[model samples]
Target: MNAPLTATGVRFADTALAQFLCTNRYTSLDELRQTATAAPRRFWHEVVTALGIQWAKPWTEILDLADGPMWPRWFVGARIDLYDNLVGRVAREDPNRPALRWEADDGATRTHTYAELDQEARRLAAGLAGLGVQAGDRVALYLPMCPEAVVTMLATTRLGAIVVSLFSGYGPDSVASRLQDAGVSLLICADSFQRRGKSVPMLDDARAAVARCPTVRNLLVVARGESPAATPPDGSHWHTVDYQQLIAHVPVTQGPAIHPADTPLMLIYTSGTTGKPKGVLHTHTGFPIKAAQDQLMAFDLKPRDTLMWVTDMGWMMGPWLVFGGLLRGATLVLFEGTPDHPGPDRLWDLVRRHDVTHLGLSPTLVRLLMAAGPAALPDALPDTLRVFGSTGEPWNDGPWHWLYDTVGQGRRPIINYSGGTEIGGGILACFPGLPQKPCAFAGPIPGIAADVTTADGQPANGEVGELVIRAPWPGMAAGFWQDDARYIDSYWSRLPGVWVHGDWAQVDGDGHWYIHGRSDDTLKIAGKRVGPAEYESALVGHPLVTEAVAVGVPDPVKGETAVCFVTVADARRLAARPWPEWERELAEHVGTQLGKPLRPARVHLTRSLPKTRNGKILRRLVRSAYLGQAAGDTTSLESPDALDHIRQCRPAGA
Candidate 1:
């Protein structure tokens, strides 16, 4: 077995975690973790008070576990509003502090102070009230990541209304499905926004979506660029208003609406593995507190830090960034274009120019940058960088090392966080103070009772198993919107008393945690099981390979066999050698590294893999294409054409 990486004395001494441990009287990370897990209620209470969380009315109890671990209610009997804690209090305390900074593809930049952001949110809230949108009403935001999007979200939540965040990239059908399901009463969107140096029409899709959503009574549009004015088409029943004009005369001194702790804050839909997207509902106390807690403990976010995560408004990370950064008093940076546009170093440029202290991105993006070669990277690491954050997908060693060495310059820690929209924040994350190995988690976040367990419920170590939560945390979704049964079946059905998160995980002897892959994506070959990531990591470790996806295909002799789909770093190198010889060598390399039984039965070359907008490879879709089966739920696929490449390159007859 390989030895675990150990942090140097200087790195450990300078971390925020070191400060926290000293202040809290904890000797080590292990001591802190044990204390946090021993009594979660007390830990959370301390955390909330330490963070100075504001509430309309204090809770009589910290937690209500009477309903069982799966349905634990947190912050019981408390009355609060998200905007009060996130925007109102911050604005009052530091009115001139930088709250938001946005940069466009064309080099246009905008910054908003805390006071300015609060006033804008109040104006939008007043306008929403004028349109008869009251408490509990669902308002869909179909705009990109801009200042207006943040304003609209805060405004809606301030009025105790639920905001349905629609992905800006979604077509009319996708937008309509979510809007109709949520029974949205109003929609706020942008006329157009620049993507890859081109004007993309968003309001046009919003208009088309409204035509199909009979529940929407108003359509408000923001003019994002100098594109043609957006107007409601002929014979539309809904009233159309310019966003600026609608909020122009609204007062900016109104107070936020008070609601109980469990008041629905937002209806964020998950990209479904099957059927329509499930609405993952969150409340004022549930999502915001959890997001802030994670930011504070895991990332050690500070008011002076500028935190930026590359994501769209439609993804969970979008709201995560807004609520988490603000609650922690950090300046949030928003970018409205591709990271690699204009040049491969555009992301690095943004980091340098914005003085981003904590920069987050997907491993897929790092792979793209790696393919561009080291020359594409900045000559030096950004001077202000304090931490590197990553999520969205599991990391491969190649890109992980590139990000660690080339980007972070071996001076900062890479905080690997993993969770889903349903969990609100991370279940497992690496702290800056801990020693980290490539692709390993420090442990479960404090206050989250997470473990890796076998099928029969025994704890498993040194072997991959299901990632389960033994106790409910504040961020657990309040069941799927209008579908309680489906929510129960999806998460709780797999384990008796635990929340079975659909991922394979393992814990090493030294206490380091590792997420293998999605449990559903596990491959069973000759009665032996393996996560797809195990094969992918092996294949990507090869010199010439850039990306790879391993899938289990039906086999007659063995129950299943591995089929590998790969893309190369240099296509010219492939043409220099015989294709058959190269494929054989790659398969033998896997056999040599992982044993003969784990070797891929066939290797197929491809140009790209099917991935989501967030860059998570769709292994199920790849398997479907190989088996000539219907690809279920390609709605989240970013490159649908990548499936055609998989089908074209599939090996003939098993």
Candidate 2:
């Protein structure tokens, strides 16, 4: 038996983690690891039983990982479909109970009940079947966050088809890469989407993708903004029937049963920089369990809690929000508009209206809101709000504290969940029982055995190292879509036996985890290493600066020197105040924020930085343009000319 773990006097909210910590159910972290490692089948068996998963067929055996490292069979005898678990198994007492609430950018709102969603999904399943979609067929979904998108996801799951999600804003190249890589046969998208009072042509991008990739057999386009100016000459069709109308045509016979643990629920593509994006395959049982675990343990989500996560269907958070909320029988609030669009109070209004208990947002979004100035935000959160969740990137202490003190009144804990689509859910998350430290992750989840280790494969506590999962969990992805070799090479090659996640991290003496940044993005200058995000985090802490980006440029003595780009809220005001004094004050701000060694060699003020529609700063493009290198893949950029202005602001000689 593993030894017991002490709580160490950390308490924030009333969550399952608090219950686990107080009850001493499992004892120590080692004990939890032992359950996952010692007898993996038995451990998962217990978890599945606890989740009350409705398996159509019983499993004769649990897990068989001994045969090979990659081919681990979970729930060997069960045969069940994911739609059955997601839709059919919900409580029948309240058939009209709301499942999803979608708000469009143009002030259109729609609500779907569990029964409605299930029926619509079945209708779409029948429609897909008519289109020759089979059990193992691949279906590509490039639609926005609407009823059709949710129905398509559920419909594909219902039919045992692999649903590959593509971002609605992805250009032809990215969409083609994902479609070709996944061998997707059918595509679903809308004519266009409204963003910031502009109609963005999402269907045009999809058509362009299909033109490049001939494997796509059919295109199903939904009308959103206006009819497209053009269409494919071949097999293109318009989506006319409402999701409910389509589902009413199909018979609601309980589909063929599948193994609870063996069925693939969803395939979320990873965000790649260099090579082709890898499709991370997640199973029905393991994936949903992890989502539920995180929702309950990290956020303390319950049925009475209404949760909202600002994300699109293409992102991992979209699926995480869906399954986690449904598995816990919680309400999900979805907004289709940009968080800051129409006004900065849009998000705040949603929280107020819905009485959302848990709110999940990106660190970038929080930082952007902070950039809008403190006066732009409400002084406090709604009384119903209990916790805030942060993901995607590591957070700076400034935004973290601002969210905690101003919005939460220092009572709510920010459940920082750090994991990829490949892991289905979080590997490291904040527990409510753990002391709410500003900008620090709580610890590895109870069932997840994770550690921070140096390059030499040695554990490093209170020091920087790579974050790796020491053992496997039920939620681990099967592999990249048809790219098993690449999966093995990309993740397993870094460390012989361990799962390398490629995130730099440090664990404090109290076991608080802090993610530095991506290991691949680490910068080396003058024989000293630093993360670009580290500098950006420091610069954003300044009162005058709203946002910042750091890039490395070649230098004679330093090999590479740091070039910082900052966007101040009112730069003209600062300049009008004083001349050299203001410059010194701003530079001194960076110095005081980050200390000298990590300070930028040069700082340039820019009106705006190039970013994707989702607000991801294009650091590599900024770096490449600064270094006079070709900026590859600029098609997905929100504004192509945004870089032109950034370039003009560069120092004369640089």
Candidate 3:
């Protein structure tokens, strides 16, 4: 049996995870993993039924692996509709229950009950149908975190039309590329949204992108009490449809369409280190089941709990929040504002005011918050706060502990969840029912048969190795849309049947799981391999280093050496010191934490780090930008201009 890293200091004794496992006759999480994986079909049936995901027809088989593990289909003969299960069912059961709550940067708020959301979704679905969107047609969504974003998502999927999420910050080219690639027939976007008390005209980019993509028939605009940014060009073929007009003109005569459980419900694109971005297809049963199950296991999310994860629709967590929170009949707090907009206390104030029970944040955000210190936040969390969810990147011990001590108040467990647009929810998670640790996942939550493999494909015991999944779970992506071969090469081709999750992971002596960094970002200095996170963690461990990103640079003797870029917590304090002296001290710090051999060769101070919309550090892009090489697939980057700062960090005569 896997031992706990610490004593069973479970914050919640009767956690949803423990109750579900015990009720199913399992003794512990490990036992559940072993037994459920042994009977995968039966386990899925029980899980789906327990999660309240109803089916129109019973499935003859839970899974079919005849097509191989890379393309396993789920719920072979069952018929299900995500909207009906997520909204219709809940609205009927408790119509007045709050489905979603929205708060803007300006302190404006809006609430939607299950009944209201259900009707809005149905009405939007009818509007899309009236506008000529058919089942299986792709509809792109490029709106901010608002009520319409969620409604449109449900509406599109309700009509069996696959909803494609685009990052709200994407420029014209990036937006046009995904739209053209998906053959999108319609796009829903906001005219503008407030961030830091400033209006960002999204319709400008949406119009610019749609003009380039001939396949888009209509550009639907969600008026955010802001006027349209610009008039359409004279020759633009797509019509601009007001969001309210589209919904108001149509009356829903029917409910959601029943689809095969394995039918494509959503398409999410994942940009890699190289090559074109791959679109991951998710089924009605696949993503939602894994999302809800993981939420229950990891966060102990309940019907009364309110969840708020800082994410955009472009990322997986956005859809996960919509489906998982609503599928379980939980309230959602949608904050469409920057964390430090009005003040550093903006996030904490949102939590306190919204009564958010479960709040999710990224390690990057926590580091930023630490700069302002605890005094910038509330004295204590609201009484409603219970669970803390964290993802997007691996946490360093410093930020993780700060989040635990300051924000979590030493009571909440910072559930470090790790997964992607492809995996649906999480492969590893920190269960609230298990022992707590600073920066470690308890293990695979449930359904995920996670394992670590050595360089030779042998089992890795208490050693750093490739994180691989031994068995296919229901949430696995159906395939990369229109690119089956690329999908195979991405995950399955490397280890045959085993799914090679790109991150390097390890199991420590006490059975704690930790992610080092992406496998592609690992540096081999003199044939000794180490991930960038090690170097980054060492730098950020210092109180002055608010953020850091490390990448490999070519070396004459060592083959590869680490180059770390960091943002300072105190600009004035850093400016007081000479660059050479500070660089020496930082390098020595890393040497002290790791070893002399693994110390970073150089440290450069930067204003900011390049990150994705969901706050994941773009290590590959950083390396490319610094090395003056071609940066590949930068569509997912939240701030492309940050690359210029890294490029300027390049030293002369180096």
Candidate 4:
């Protein structure tokens, strides 16, 4: 049995969930756990009913997977358009109700109601049709997190056109690759965005990429930031638009709503072994359900809650945050600049101002914030704050505890969620009603058949193994976009029928789950396998240390030896503090947190670590550099310079 969870940490205001608690009151954590375990299908069905999903054509079957693998249908015959469901229905109820609240790093904010969003979506959809974009035609959206991007997505989906959301930070090559793969008909981008205190020329890159994409015919440019010094050549032909121009011309007409349950809504491309990107196709029912379910359970989402998760359109979390927040009728706050750019307290300031109920972040970002000190965080938040969710990379107990103590008052839960772009939502998540354990996931969500198995496919306890989902669920991506064979080979080939996600996991005797690290980064040192997260977790416990990355480099004797890269609070001061004085203390700290055998062979101090736009450490780049291999994809790196600094460092014991 799991540890008894007590409801003694955080309390809620007279909020949306407070009434739910009163009507169907749960006194203890055990009661909440029992409610979920006792009737999971009933819980989900209730969620569906509560969300009030419009059924234009009634569903013949809510869910059907009986035939075999590769075929799954949800809300079988429901004919409601996803865009219509999100915007139309909501607007019909209260057109003036705020649907999107956008805030930039400059403190500029805009609020758009459901009617405004619907009208903008209609105009955007009409503009695309005028540009000759047809159903199933891919439209590449390379814009920042604005109302335009959101409306563009819904408009495209409404027309049955697959929307490919490209990260605004993506360069020409990255943009060209996705555009070519998708055979896009239209390209949407902004003039530029403010990044690192400077205006970036987003349109310049989009123009360059469009030149390479033969299928791209029209360019819809949102005039934002500074006016570009040089516009696209006349022959290239650009249709200029501002916040109003795009929506002003077109009439509001609900487009055709397609329903297949298997029909692809979005094509999200992820990196593959061959260095080619594989598009992960997500359908309406599967994607929406997973997003709604995960957010509901993982963060204890309620209608009155306000959430802010830092992410870009390119990353999966971008969509995850959107669907998750909206599905639960929660308020979503978006920031258009770096989380710590110009200052460290940017995120926390937003949190305090918005009265955010749940804040989702990654460990790498937490480590960066820790380096800035807790002074970077705001002192108080809404007394209603209940959950803090994290993902992207493995977390340390230090940040885990800090999240609870500082932000959550030691009572709120730090949900360590793990999943991939293809999974749509987290496969493993910690529920608010579960016992709060530092750096440990509560368990696999009920209805999800999850386990950590050895290489031979046998289950193990307290031993790190491959995390796999044994059963097909509603949210599994249909397949790689237009690459069926690669999709089959990537996920299904490893273990026939079982979804073998490339993650390392462990389970305690009491059934708590823990993500070790990515399976690819699992280090084999002197015949013993160790997860980098284990050592990173240990290093985080040090008072002066902020963040660390453990990479396995090829060694003549050990096959692979551990090399740790550290970013500390007083980076230069710590380096000059004399290892003779503090080395023993630091070594002892590691020994206490992790076993002696798992200690890093060498520790190299650095000022900063490379991170992705979504705040994941670029461990692959670190490992590739140590192994003298190519840095496969630097497109996602938040700081490309960190890899160069790592490459210039001397080898261990040199």
Please identify model 1 stretches exceeding 4 Å from their true place.
Answer: 6-16, 651-654
Scored by CA lDDT, what does every candidate get?
A: 0.85, 0.73, 0.85, 0.74
Q: Please, what are the lDDT tens digits per residue for candidate 4 over residues 133-179?
A: 77788988898877777888878877878889888888999999999
Candidate 4: list runs displaced more than 4 Å.
1-47, 228-231, 237-243, 254-258, 575-592, 650-654
Q: Compute the lDDT of residue 607 as modeled in candidate 1.
A: 91
Model 3 CA deviation exceeding 4 Å by range: 1-12, 225-231
RMSD of each: 1.8, 4.0, 2.0, 3.5
Sort the candidates on lDDT, descending order: 3, 1, 4, 2
Residue 50, candidate 3: alpha-carbon lDDT: 73
TM-score per candidate: 0.97, 0.90, 0.97, 0.91
Model 2, 1-654: lDDT tens digits are: 111122322343355645544454666544765676666676666666545566777878877667454556777767765666666556354667777788888767888888877777777888788768887788888877777887787788777787888777788888988888887888887887877777777766787787766677777767665444344664443322333334556776455536445677778887566565678988777677778777866777876478898887788888788777777777778787788878776788778877888888887788778777765487566778777888877777788777776666666778888898888889888766556467777787766778889887898766778888867777788888788998888778878778889888888766677787788667786566677777877777777777788887767777777778887777667766664464466666767866765556777777788876556677877876666667766644677776886778666786
Model 1 C-alpha lDDT per residue in residues 1-654, reported as the tens digit of each score: 434454332266665556667877888877777788787777778777766788888999988989877677888899886787788888888899999899998778999999899989999999999999999999999888899999988998888999998888888888999999999999998988888899888887888899999899999888866754556777887988888887888877565667899888898888766678999999888888888888877887877689999988888999999988888888999999888888998998999888899898888888888888865688776668888899977888878878887666676778899999999989999887667878888898887889998987888857889999888888889889899889889999978878999999999887888898899899998677898988888888898888899999898899899999999878999977888888999999898878998899988999999987667888989999999988876766777799999999766782
Clashing pairs in 2: 10-433, 10-435, 78-259, 79-258, 79-259, 80-258, 80-259
Q: Model 4: how far is 48 from its true place, Å?
A: 2.9
Better of 1 and 4 by lDDT: 1
Model 3 per-residue lDDT tens digits across residues 1-654 = 333433233455678877787778887778888877898887887788678787788888788999887778788888987778888888888899999999998999999999999889899988898899988999999989999999988888788899999888888988998998999999999998888899887887898899889999988988876454354778888888888878888886475578888878899988877887789999888888999999888888988689999999888999999988888889998989898878888888899988998999898888888888755667778778877899878888888877776666677778889988899999999877568667788888678889999966799888789999989998889889999888888888778789998899998877788899889889998677788888888898886788898899998888889999999877888778898889999999999998998888999988888998667888988999999889988888878889999999887753
Candidate 4 similarity to native, TM-score:
0.91
